[model samples]
Target: ILHSQISTIEKQATTATGCPLLVRCKNFQLLQLVIPQERDCHDVYISLLRLARPVKYEELYCFSFNPKLDREEREQGWMLIDLSEEYKRMGLPNNYWQLSDVNRDYRVCDSYPTQLYVPKSATAHIIVGSSKFRSRRRFPALSYYYKDNHASVCRSSQPLSGFSARCLEDEQMLQAIRKASPGSDFIYVVDTRPKVGVTTLVCVFAAPSHGMRDEAMLPDPLREPHLQGGFAQPCMAALLSCLLGPRSSWRA
Candidate 1:
């Protein structure tokens, strides 16, 4: 690590989480630092940056030198993701969509997580029936709901029916999903499944009232998604693009 010993300049003043820093060398070396003091932490971090990249004299090095940070009102790291807090940010449990623990015990869908957020228009019967029709009972569920346009990102496994088969209840549930997002004129499908799977979703997800768009082929995912307020992981860029559209800036 770059600053492993942590030059204990101040014994009294110490960071709550013990100021940790990571530096990646060009030779594939990852160095870590845990400066205890606030001033020392800042000093060590800046020193590391300067060491990595030298600057000219009187150039105001710190002016346009911005560093990425993850923080809140309090100091913490590797925090557990709170589902309620996350959904609250999305402005859920409104007239259109609601949170249901119907699958709390994972009885309806073993693969799906508890606390299902779905369209309020969908009935209990419709959900149960939809589960039965889907592969591994992984029925359609909302992944993200855009507050700006009220556009949603719903995910689901392939329907059990390959192409010819159809499920009335499954169709009804998907129809309710469209009604929940009134802002969008079209229901864009981002299918990562094979040809038969993609074709199956199109066959079942298509409704009479809503237009269907097959965006199965996702755009090249950005290498650094966090630059534009996107998903932290680069792989998720494809899903984010498909859900939010090509010209989207959905904050993580």
Candidate 2:
């Protein structure tokens, strides 16, 4: 089966809402898993709405790993090309995209090293930053960061800052978030492990008219029941909430 853990989430104005002057941040965590791809991932599908119109989408972004390439492989030359013609010929979205390194050595963190397919429409932005985090007990994690007209998506080994102390209590972690995201309004939770109880931190750069959302702090008792001495489950919960909730606004 295909398992998913939302690590980060970001949103601002949508095509429906139009671009607004202010931005709000709501960081949360959530995830869902799908069955493993048997074969021909191109068969997987989804849809999108443009200008209140419906558009069918095929082509998917696959996430994977490369034990051969270390951290350095990610930086050099990455490109997000508009593969609309290629996708349309294959019955995919005209805006469908494929990530490529200028050299085309096959990206280290594209999808499942084996390849996990997701609809093209799911990618709201053309370019996405990618990374991988590996823990001893579980499978290596792959994360994708994207940026659109309003929302910016990012993933890190560290947490993002600026929601509220009630939601995220670590000061140092929050500082890291601020450094990574200076002007972003929201952070998207793309990958995370809840059972492991890893805490993620993110920050907000802009605020809407109402100020910010009041998120309920998770109880200390219910979180980090018996994991490591430093692990925090509440942060993972908050990460999921931001990712799976409405794409338009943040709740926490």
- lDDT of all predictions: 0.63, 0.29
Q: Give stretches of model 2 more than 4 Å off.
A: 1-98, 106-184, 188-231, 246-252
Count the clashes in each prediction.
Answer: 0, 35
Task: Report the lDDT of model 1 for residue 90.
Answer: 91
- Put down candidate 1 lDDT per residue, 221-252, tens digits, no spaces: 20111122233366466556645767456666
Residue pairs with colliding backbones in model 1 are none
Q: What TM-score, over all chains together, does every model reach?
A: 0.49, 0.20
lDDT for each residue of candidate 2 in 77-105, tens digit (9 for 90 to 100): 34343343333343322132233231123
